[model samples]
Target: MKTLLTITLTSLLTFNIAFAQTPEERGLEIAIESDKRDTGFADQLAEMLMTLRNAAGKESIRKVRVKTLEVSGDGDKSISIFDQPRDVKGTALLSYTHSTKPDDQWLFLPALKRVKRIASRNKSGPFMGSEFSFEDITSFEVDKYTYKYLRDEEVEGKATFVIEQFPTYQASGYTRRIVWVDQEIYQPLKVEFFDRKNSLLKTLTFHDYQQYLDQYWRADRQEMVNHQSKKSTTLLFNNYQFKTGLTDRDFDQNSLKRAR
Candidate 1:
C-alpha cells in the first residue's frame, strides 16, 4: 500500500499548487485581460461637454474636442482642445502616456500664445479647475500600478470584479484606487480614489457605455464627485469616430497651438 499512499500524497500536493494564486497575481491577470479587450483601434475622435459644479452649486461649462492615437508597445497619445467658453477658448492639453515612465504633457494657453510643459510633480492637480485631476485624464496603463484583488460584486445589476491598485509612479496624489470592473464589457464601472492620507477623496462613475467597432466599448458619460470639497464634474462625450487616421504629429506641442 506504500505506492498508493505516495500517489495520494502527490495528488494532494499538486492540487494545493494549482490553487495557490495570491490576490496580487489575480488582480494583475484581470487588469491584463481588461487591457487586452480594448486594443487595436488605430485612432479616435470625439467631442465632450464638461460641466463643473462648485460647492455653492454654481455651474460652468466647457466644450472640448478630443483626438487619440493608439501606439504599439506603449500607451496612447491624446489631445484635448477647448472649443467654447470664451475665457478658455483655444486652450489645449496634449498628453503622451507611457506604460512605465512619467507621462509627457503640455498645455497651450491661447492668451499667452505659448505652450507650457506639465511637470510630473504637478500631475495630481486639477485640470482647468475641474474635479478630474490631470493624472485622471491620462490613458490607463496596467504597468502604472500594483494591484490587489478585493472581491466580486455587482454594480448597477452588472457583475464586476473589485480590485485595489496602488500607484508605482512618483508624486501620485492617491494612495490607492478601488476599481469596479464590469465583467461583461471588461471596462471600469466605477472607481474610488483615496488621498495620500488614505482618506476617501473622490469617486468616479461611468454611465451609458456604447460599443464601437463591434469590439470597443466607450462610456458616453462620466461623473466625478469630490467628497471633501463637495465639488463635482460631469463629462458627456459625443460624436465618437474611430480609425480617424490620426498621427503623432497631431499630438505634438506645435499641434496644441494650432488646435483651434
Candidate 2:
C-alpha cells in the first residue's frame, strides 16, 4: 500500500510540474513566436532624414542627401539633393511613391531650368548612380511583406529570432528576405535579400539604433550590398521625429508637386 501511495504521489508531482507554467507564461511564449513572424524593420513614423552614398571607387566618392516624409495610408514623399562630385550642385530629385501604383519621380535640373519626370520603367534603375535600386528608397512597412519564423539563434551575444519575409508588392524585385532580429530590442540586425529568380542578391545590415520617445527604436545607419554587382549603398539617418502632427493634406497628390 505504501508503494502504491508513493507512486500516486509521484504522478501527482509530475502532473503539477507539467502544469506549473501559467497561462501568462504560455501567452508570452506565443507572443514571442508571433513577433518573430510579423515584425518589420521599422514601425510607422512621420519624418526621417537620410544620406545616401555609393561605394567608394579608387579615385572618388559619390553621395547624396535626402529628406523623406511618410503618411500612413497615403504614401511617401522625398526630396533628394546631390552632394558630391562637384559638377551637379543644387540639383534635386523628388519622388512620390505609391503603394498600389507606379511611383512618380521628378528631377529638378537647376542647369536645365526644369523639373523632368523620370521615365516610368526607370523605376527599376539605379538611383543617382548608386547600387541601390529606386525601389529601395521607399519606406518599408510590415504590410508590404508576409513573414514566417525560421529559427532562433544568438547574434553578437544576444539571442536572435530569424525570420523570412516575402514581399507582396508587385514592383519589388526581391522574392524573399531572411532577417535576423535581436530578441531583446526587436530590431532587425541583418537581412539577406533574394532576387526574383531566388538567387542571393543583396545583404542589408542595420546599426547604431537609438530609441525615440521611450517607445520607438530607429536605426541610424543601413548598408546594402549587391552580391553580384560588387557595389553597395550606405544610408545614414538623422533627425528622426515621430507623430509630428502631419495631416492627410500633407500627403495628397497635389502636395507631391509642391513638396520641398
Best by lDDT: 1
Q: Give the 10-residue window scoring lowest on summed lDDT in candidate 2.
A: 40-49
Candidate 2 stretches with Cα past 4 Å from truth are 1-60, 121-123, 239-260
Give each model's whole-structure lDDT.
Answer: 0.90, 0.65
Per-model TM-score versus the true fold: 0.91, 0.67
Worst 10-residue stretch by lDDT in candidate 1?
A: 119-128
Clashing residue pairs in candidate 2 are none
RMSD of 2: 7.9
Expressed as tens digits, the lDDT of each residue in 1-260 for candidate 1 is 99999999999999887688789998999999988888888899999899999999999998988899998788799898888788788889888888667788888988889999877576688877899987787777788889999999999999999999999877788999999999999899999999999999999999999999999999999999999999999999999999977798988877888987
